[model samples]
Target: MMMTPADLDAFAIGFMLTERLADSTRDVLSVEPFEAEAGWIVRVTLADRCRGRIHDRVRHRTSDTGCGLCGIASLEQLRRPVAHIPPRPRSGARALFSAIAALRDHQPLNGATGAVHAAAACAPDGTIVAAYEDVGRHNALDKLIGATAACGVPGFILVTSRISFEMADKALVASTPMLVGISAPTTLAVDHARAHGLTLVALARADAMLVLNDPWNCFDAVAGEGLEPPTPGL
Candidate 1:
């Protein structure tokens, strides 16, 4: 899940915005180089309304399925502390369908290694805004968030992997509010998405998708008529 410092920026932004952790979705206030264990630490400033949304945070890396869970007996970790989302309008199916299809074309890393996981932010018109790939799915998301923090705002994020708890946590930390995944999401992911005001969509592809938590956002599109929505187990 290792990536260059520059790549991590994009991971953070994509992870946050696509996951609906960031309502502002603005650019980074500033990016100062650091010598911490992680490549760098980013400081993002939000609008007046979103400023107070963040109080304290616990940041850590989630690499595997085991890393993104509760009661793991980790030294210091969260028991899933997240706020609620206000239910923003859902993104249309036509838009999502096109974005996911076109996302692969922009994946430079996957072009080389099909095994790598990718993440991207796309414009409303299906234009690929920013893209990043990493060995691990969570790292790809972290890079997306970092990228969004440095660069301008992105419309949404798309992941090549399944929606998991770590993905939800990273999105919450970034404060963006929309996440789309190629596969299904776990119960923990859905719970966190609802608590943190995130719109989590899973199994989105050619003609189908699911809305595990739509309170923060919905998928409204004329082209979505024939497509069936995914059913959350809970």
Candidate 2:
């Protein structure tokens, strides 16, 4: 089933704080949905230790399709310091294609709705460890993070949507070493990936992919198969 805004927001707030706030430091009390001028708002109430308070509310405004980092009140909230990610072994083009094929095979939600985005965790060898789908790309990632929080699945993340700054931030928060996208990434996303030592790949297809940043060089294409190299200067 497609995720409701309330469910999406709950996962987002819950997991977003999972790294920043220790489980003993905070707890999500409730998630309520409300109508807003911009879109539907998911109000998350939490018990916070930082403020020594019983109630701290964070509002998440989500569009019908679910955009990340929306309805923020300040620029400071838009940027977060990503943790340094250790390098992982290079994933060959064959492995990437296999993982994408697995993700597509398992995405029943996308097959049914054609409206959801997916986030998957793939092992170093390219096997899909786990996957989640949601109306919003961020929600998909959040759900995947929350689902795998305790499982300690160490692998790269693959998304069926464009790589946005928020997507990069979320993966970094999850301590993911690499992120692959079916579409291109924003400049801010690339910058964050570079600064945080996270490998970012995009425009990945069955035939080829682009390596936006690979500080540890954890990506490899088939020696003579799949996508041809881009011609000079587009």
Candidate 3:
């Protein structure tokens, strides 16, 4: 479509879920462009049963770049609670470190735009299984979550952006055990990770990185001592 974002596949699916645009991925029958007086609008064809749940009349909203979190109209939606954290089922921080090291391979879309964020799932073997890239970091994570919901939770998430509370919320929803990134984290991200039992690995370089959450459960210890993540690079 004329107005489609460069990352349409990911953006469409991600926006649908994160905005409560549809109940599931299948609800979106197709997406195309609609010429309007203001500009082109993307009209999504939803399943007939879901037609009334979400109206087609979209009210214009404004925000700065990277400010896609404004759709939260309800307190419950704004601050969704995570389920209690589960026990860490994997061993060895080596697996996580390897995933962080391999984050570059997951940026197929980012390689094109240099403006997209990515979220990838890595097996303990350190190979990326699935990656979703979007204009928004949280949306990227949500796309990864929606795609991975049935495959069962994996070892961790490799994000191409900094960790934030909303990122933590998406990871928790996917039941992902840990999040590794080439960036640092927000204070809220750290607290949410600890609260929900998800490991937060940040400031990852090729050789080393930091585990910035609850060390007792997150660290394998077998991989050695943990440290706080350094500041993120812009």
**Candidate 2 local Cα displacement, residue 107, angstroms:** 0.7
* Candidate 2 clashing pairs, residues 3+ apart or interchain: 207-227
Name the TM-score of candidate 1: 0.66
Q: Write the per-residue lDDT of candidate 3 for residues 59-136, one digit (tens) a residue.
A: 245422353445445445446545557446463456666776777777877787687888888886667898887676
lDDT string for model 1 (22-67, tens) is: 5434633433345578555655444555444344332344334234
Candidate 2, residues 17-52: lDDT per residue as tens digits? 533443421365665667779656566665655344
Error of 2 at 43 (Å): 9.4
lDDT: which candidate is best?
2
TM-score of candidate 3 against the unseen true structure: 0.70
**TM-score of each predicted structure versus truth:** 0.66, 0.75, 0.70
Lowest lDDT sum, 10 consecutive residues, model 1, at: 56-65
- List clash counts for every candidate, in order: 40, 1, 0
